[model samples]
Target: MEIQKNLIQLGQSFKTKEEAITFCGEQLVSGGYVTPDYVPAMLERNSELSVYMGNFIAIPHGTDAAKKEVLKTGITIVQVPRGVNFGDEEAPKIATVLFGIAGVGSEHLDLIQKISIFCADVDNVVKLADATTADEIADLLNSVEV
Candidate 1:
């Protein structure tokens, strides 16, 4: 899975989706995957469009213009076991998993596909949400193939 090679923070507790977004975005930027501007770009884009990808997962990606900010293709996954609201009122929509992806060109499609495969099974998503540690979460994703 695309997430296997990227940074992962598990069992985190963020009071808001914005907090989670900022945390993960900064991580990606610091890791040299994306420019610092990409973080704010992602937040702005998310404000325009909901990133909730179903199954209690919110995937935040930079705007098309912000693509220039990406230096490498990678994903920073932040799992908040307590969950965070993503501008939704539905009870099932509070996302417990946050996936911040930096895609270079067509890499976005591949990255999306990888995430689709990773979340194809509800049980897998549930297992991922309930994972106790970053290592466990990484091992779970690393065990899957896109």
Candidate 2:
């Protein structure tokens, strides 16, 4: 799947996970990747379950049934420097970045694998979180070995 260049957002600082998640969905929606309903669906799932991936990243996606809300397979990433808490305040699963995926069917798995590879290395994850420009983040993500 081709990654849309406009979906990347770097140097973000969200106070809460909700805000971060909403921004991710908004980015995807603004990109015409998924419908507005897809945002709530993704948020609801996030509320019901933690979407945190290791290496300080969270991969958020809508429900499986919400695939119909997606216009095309796409991805939007937000690098949150301050990070966001995905668990209890005292023991939070803080994430340095959020990768919002608007995928159709099997493309979901592919996106996850690709993103996983991107974040597999601790240095790559740190680079992404600290990236000052969108182009830097996009270039790093685009270089994922998949």
Candidate 3:
């Protein structure tokens, strides 16, 4: 998956997970990755299962049913240094890095794996979260091994 520098947003703060997801979806939509309908699908998928990966990373993508909404394969990164709660207040799953994805065909699976492996290290996730500019995040994500 190619991480477009234009799609990356650094130092963002969201009040809610929904807001964060919405921003992610909008980024994808604006980038011509998916149709507007894909946004709601992303939210629904999140509601059904937590997209929050450990190590302060969250990968938000649409459901299988929304695959038709994909216009192209794209990835957008949103950095929230302050962190946003993806779980309930009691559980508290905070995500400092959000990866919004829209994939064509089966590319999403590989993309997810690549992202997972890259973010398995907390230091890598911190590099992304602490990114000062969009290019920094893009460079880091684009450097994903495999």
Candidate 4:
């Protein structure tokens, strides 16, 4: 599936998980990707998907009725100065967070799989955590061939 560059920019600018989810939902709504009212539910779902891997990376995502109905498929990147706890026993600081929202019936599993592979690389996640701008993050993402 073709990655939506605009969605990546929307994700990169969020400072908090709540903000990230809200912004992603808003983008889905405005872009006709999802309904606006699905934001809260999406947040609730994201809370459960939060995972903090070592090296300052957090991936919080959910594919529930609200998210699946609204998002279709998109990715959002968020940077937190102090990082957030992902509910792990270690609860490591997640300096950078990425949300991958997939809607029902969307066949972008390849893109999602590629993103997962990219995030699994410690070096790439480290670089993403340190990215200073949305464009830089987007560029990094684009550099990865899905």
| C-alpha lDDT score of every prediction, in listed order | 0.81, 0.84, 0.90, 0.58
TM-score of 3: 0.96
Q: For candidate 2, lDDT tens digit of each residue in 51-141?
A: 8887899999888878899998888888788888887778889898889998877897899898888788989889888888887877777
- TM-score, one value per model: 0.89, 0.92, 0.96, 0.66
Off by over 4 Å in 4: 1-20, 47-55, 88-95, 104-109
Candidate 1 lDDT? 0.81
Q: Candidate 3: worst 10 consecutive residues by lDDT?
A: 137-146
Model 3, C-alpha of 132: deviation from truth (Å): 0.5
RMSD of 1: 2.0
User: What C-alpha root-mean-square deviation, in Å, does candidate 4 show against the real structure?
Assistant: 3.7
On the 0 to 100 scale, the lDDT of residue 105 in model 2 is 74
Reference-based lDDT, residue 128, model 2: 84
Worst 10 residues of 1 by lDDT: 1-10
In angstroms, give how far residue 12 of model 1 lies from its true place.
1.3
Ranking by lDDT: 3, 2, 1, 4
Ranking by TM-score: 3, 2, 1, 4
